[model samples]
Target: GDSVTQTEGLVTVTEGLPVKLNCTYQTTYLTIAFFWYVQYLNEAPQVLLKSSTDNKRTEHQGFHATLHKSSSSFHLQKSSAQLSDSALYYCALSASNVGDNSKLIWGLGTSLVVNP
Candidate 1:
């Protein structure tokens, strides 16, 4: 079975600094779509980034990340990170052949907190 993995647990940081959250995945199929979903304190989870093509960087909002097929990883990184970047980050995946029924499997949420 395919699966997504991320930097589990809580991540605390200051308002002005760099932050990087790890994301990795495993799939028996060669082609799969990967996504990064972010959830605020009370809002629904929204798609932050996605990748269908291999070895391409996908970014959204103030964050940017790349999907590496060879490494089976898609790690998020941001320079001079902000307080608002603090939220719950989830790594997800869907197989290319699974069609619309293809459901997204998510990793354990990563909680990021920034101090002012």
Candidate 2:
């Protein structure tokens, strides 16, 4: 079984300040992919970043995440936080080798609040 963990339940950052959303995982599965999904107030969750190769960084929009297999982490980072960056972020793990139906384990999600 695989599981994702988002340490911060809530993160607050001033506009223009750097922000990091810590994400870690524990799993025995070999072939896996990590993803960071963001959901705005009233919108469906959208894939922010995805990483399958170990030690490679994935970027989308204004956010970036590096998947470190050695540390089992894929922390999301943004150079500068903006007001529109406020959202609920979820860390998920997917094991593609499990038959034709890949299972995804999702974290409890962290809420990011950007202030002006």
lDDT for model 1 comes to 0.84
Q: Write the per-residue lDDT of candidate 2 for residues 1-116, one digit (tens) a residue.
A: 57888966889999999999999999877689999999999999999899899988788888999999889899999999999999999999997665656779999999999999
Runs of candidate 1 with Cα error greater than 4 angstroms are 98-101
TM-score of each: 0.90, 0.93
Clashes of 2: 0
Runs of candidate 2 with Cα error greater than 4 angstroms are 98-101
lDDT string for model 1 (30-112, tens) is: 45788888999999999999888877777787788888888989898887778888889998887655344456778997999
